[model samples]
Target: MTKLAEMQCEACQVGAPQVSDEELANLIKMIPDWAVVVRDGVMQLERVFKFKNFKLAMAFTNALADLAETDFHHPGILTEWGKVTVTWWSHSVKGLHQNDFIMAAKTDELLISGK
Candidate 1:
């Protein structure tokens, strides 16, 4: 199977299917650093990336923005002094989708690539 980071996100529509429990189990393993969280009754994939300082955090946030723009799938980003919390979910489906996992893996790649 193709790695999540190598997979391109497909256009998600309002009736798109959410990831199944089996798929979520497998995908979550690929992004172990991220947590499966429920906020306001919505299931989301979230992770807090640490940086040395505010500047670094902002830089990472900007890089993530570029990725989101390219995929046309945005995340909820909380940037702070030394950390950035990213939350991925498919608003169109009102739940978690494969794109969220793909983006989460790519987000991890940003750190690995030192973006």
Candidate 2:
């Protein structure tokens, strides 16, 4: 089977479920680094963007914002000295929908492109 098939099957095994608060929290703990637990009890996939300085971080943030706007899906972003934390969750579902994973993969692509 293809990778997509595998992922889909795996998701289905979990009932194609939207992650519960407890489950999401456990998953985040299992997958450390560049991820956090959100205040709304959702999964927040974060990445620490190390830029040369604050200026670069701001520029990246702007570009990232544009992408999010175009997708019509937004994430919670926290900008600091040289890092940006991005968190994604489906507010409508009040949990983690498949769209969250798709966005997370796209977000990973964005980060990979930067490298």
Candidate 3:
């Protein structure tokens, strides 16, 4: 199977079907560090990336912003002194979509690439 990081995101529309339980089970394996969270009754994929200091955390935040622009998908990001919390979900669908998984994998890649 192709790695999620290597996959591209598809345009998500309102009413798009959220991932099924089986699909979530499989996809979650690829991003084991991420947590599936429900906020306001919507499922979201979330993870926290740690950094050395505020500067590094901000750098990663900027890089992630660029990546989101490139993918045309955005995530809720909270940058702190030593870590950044990223939450990915399809706002259009108001739930978790495959795009969330794809972006989560890509976000992990940013760390692996030393962003």
- For each candidate, give its TM-score against the true structure: 0.98, 0.64, 0.97
Q: Compare the candidates by lDDT and give the number of the best one.
A: 1
Two-way lDDT contest, 1 vs 2, winner = 1
Q: How much does candidate 1 score in TM-score? A: 0.98
CA shift at 83, candidate 1, in angstroms? 0.3
lDDT of 1 by residue, 1-115 (tens): 6999999999999999999999999999999999999988889999999999999999999999999999999999999999999999999998899999999999999999987
The true-versus-predicted C-alpha distance at residue 72 of model 2, in Å, is 0.6
| Deviation in Å, model 1, residue 47 alpha carbon | 0.2
Instruction: Tell me the lDDT of candidate 3.
Output: 0.94
| Candidate 3 per-residue C-alpha lDDT over 22-95 given as tens digits, one digit per residue, 9 for 90 to 100 | 99999999999999999999999999988889999999999999999999999999999999999999999888
RMSD of 2: 5.8
Error of 1 at 2 (Å): 0.9
Give Cα-based local distance difference scores for all models: 0.97, 0.61, 0.94
Using TM-score as the measure, which candidate wins?
A: 1
Whichever of 2 and 3 has more lDDT, that candidate is 3
